[model samples]
Target: MKLNVAALLALSVPCFAQQDPNAVEAGRLVFRMSCAGCHGLHATGGRGGPDLTRGTYSTGDADKDLFSVISNGVPGTEMPSFRGALEDANISRLVAYVRSLSHAGAVPVKGDRTAGEKLFWGKGSCGQCHRVGMRGTAIGPDLTRAGKQRSLAYLRESVVAPDADLTPGYATIVVVTRDGAKITGVEKGFDNFSARLIDLSGRYYSFLKDDVKSMEREYRSVMPSNYGRMFSANDLDDLLAYLASLGGER
Candidate 1:
């Protein structure tokens, strides 16, 4: 007996339904088959892969966004394409699972503005690169009006994993001098003969092509790494909450 075209197509569909995968189970399977060798069996990366549970990628990633990356694979990295290896539905399920693993919690703790203010200035060192209420350094952008621009979640990611999403005018450049000196600074300007750098000291330095050896531009962020480990969980939550409260206060 011959089947109709629609019937044949229906038959071709995989037995698995489109229901969201059991987060834990999907993560377990993904970790075992594809990610385990490089990333440890529990998603803690090994030699070839960075730890997914504790790194920048963990705290800042969104579900759909992670799914795309997992499916498409980053170019020029050790990460390989899983497009054909896993079906699209399965990829979505995997993303959900990864998100489940990274979810610190659904609700952020209520913050103490007074304590947050102290930490922001004293312990967090946020002022080193950010400006608040006309105070603090200008090495980074002014955060006096941050609440107007970003959500609490976005602000949280900015603190814990600033590099995951680079804001404009904030890209950093690395320069290697002819004298074997290396300098990295925010990009001020560039032409064939000259390049300008704005260092952490908020000083702008100009360099001529003849005096420079090599220069490289990184598309990623220049913010210091390992910021996630710098603060206790509550500290991170309070800081994010405080940042979210800014601008709207006035």
Candidate 2:
């Protein structure tokens, strides 16, 4: 499943001229239209997607692996197959653009990571919902590999405006049973026929729409949106530094 020698050459060349300049540009445009939502504008990752600019991927690092994942999508994940949506040539161009991103270095973060760690567990109370490296609750997205899976800009926005880009399954849900009992928790699953939720205490519940009086899915995040006001500028920088330091080579 190797790409042609020309494509492989383009990966090593600065201009990628061997693959044709037009193809690289086309791939950049295609990525912006199709892949940027999850992978970030710079292919650094967004909305829980893994960073592709790191020259490594969870799906495998071969050119064939990238092509296969794009064409066939990963099961049990948000990535969707583009086999029907894009032509083979377009997919190749995308690969070219993605490879180009590896030439760029990661942006440096500011603030003290130690201070940020303190804020995460103490002042921020972030551990109450978010988990990092086997600690904290599972109510929110795990930060165990946050450094590798999200862009710094995306992480900054998440702390101040969580609802701006909601994660797939962490939305808020409210349900009222037939007996007048109300339940509110993070949505675990939802469909036309059924809904599942997990409360703060890590309790899970499922209900059939027919059996419940009402079920409301709030397409916004359950994470607090007041961190911007709560933390000082330095504190925010410290937090970002700590987050950026997570999941890197130990």
Candidate 3:
């Protein structure tokens, strides 16, 4: 049996990355400027981005695959085409940097994971609004893969200051009807003329601006803001460890 050139190149991505330190460094700069905001400075995932150091990607894993995704971007995703923003050589360097990170280890979490799980379900009361795997409710963002999708720092800030970085579409929406009924929930849809929301009960509602007495989309999180004061520092670290461990094995 013989492997094709493309297969050989893919198999030796790590080797290619190691052979050229200058290119890798250049790529690192490019990644820092263009992708670090979403992917984290270390490519460990940040905000809503996926972890790139996991050695696996939702898109194809070849160098060419990475190049394509960066140049053209993934449809229906936050990823945007960089073809116009960067030159071809820069994209290649970026791919090399990403490949170099394939074997990088996940950041160590200092807290106790078991204790964190307890905090999540017990003291944290997070299960009421958030779902991890199939165990919790759906009122908040599904955290089944949060460990893989967010950075440790991001998670910490989220727990203590929920409004610091609002997850897209999770902003609180308040609507008042002409009859004096008030409705509040996360934003499902919004426009100059209409708004849509889903409450804690998972009920969906849509209303036109003219039909409703008033509608306000507060650019803030509905999650409690006093978690920093509610839990001790150790408790926060424990919870973060558990969260960082999610989807890590994949």
Q: Pick the candidate with the highest lDDT.
A: 3
> lDDT per residue, candidate 1, 1-250, as tens digits?
2324344233333333224334446545766788777665666444345445532352136655677778887666567889999877566656655666556443433776667778888888879878888788877777886643444555677778888767666788778998899888877777677778788877778888888998766766767766689888878777766775575244
Report residue 57 deviation for candidate 1 (angstroms): 31
State, as a TM-score between 0 and 1, how close model 2 is to the true structure. 0.68
Instruction: State the TM-score for model 1.
Output: 0.53
Q: What is the TM-score of each candidate against the true structure?
A: 0.53, 0.68, 0.72
Given candidate 3, what's the lDDT at residue 186? Answer: 85
Best by TM-score: 3
**Candidate 3 CA-lDDT value:** 0.82
- Tell me the tens digit of each residue's lDDT in model 3 across 1-250: 3324344334433423445445577778889999998898888778957678867665789988888999998766677899989877668778888988876664567999999999999998999889888788887888887775677778888899999999888889999999989999988889899999888787889999999999999999878898999999999999998987776243
Q: What tens digits encode model 2's per-residue C-alpha lDDT throughout 98-133?
A: 777776775557789999999999999999998897
Computed on alpha carbons, the lDDT of every model, listed in order, comes to 0.66, 0.81, 0.82
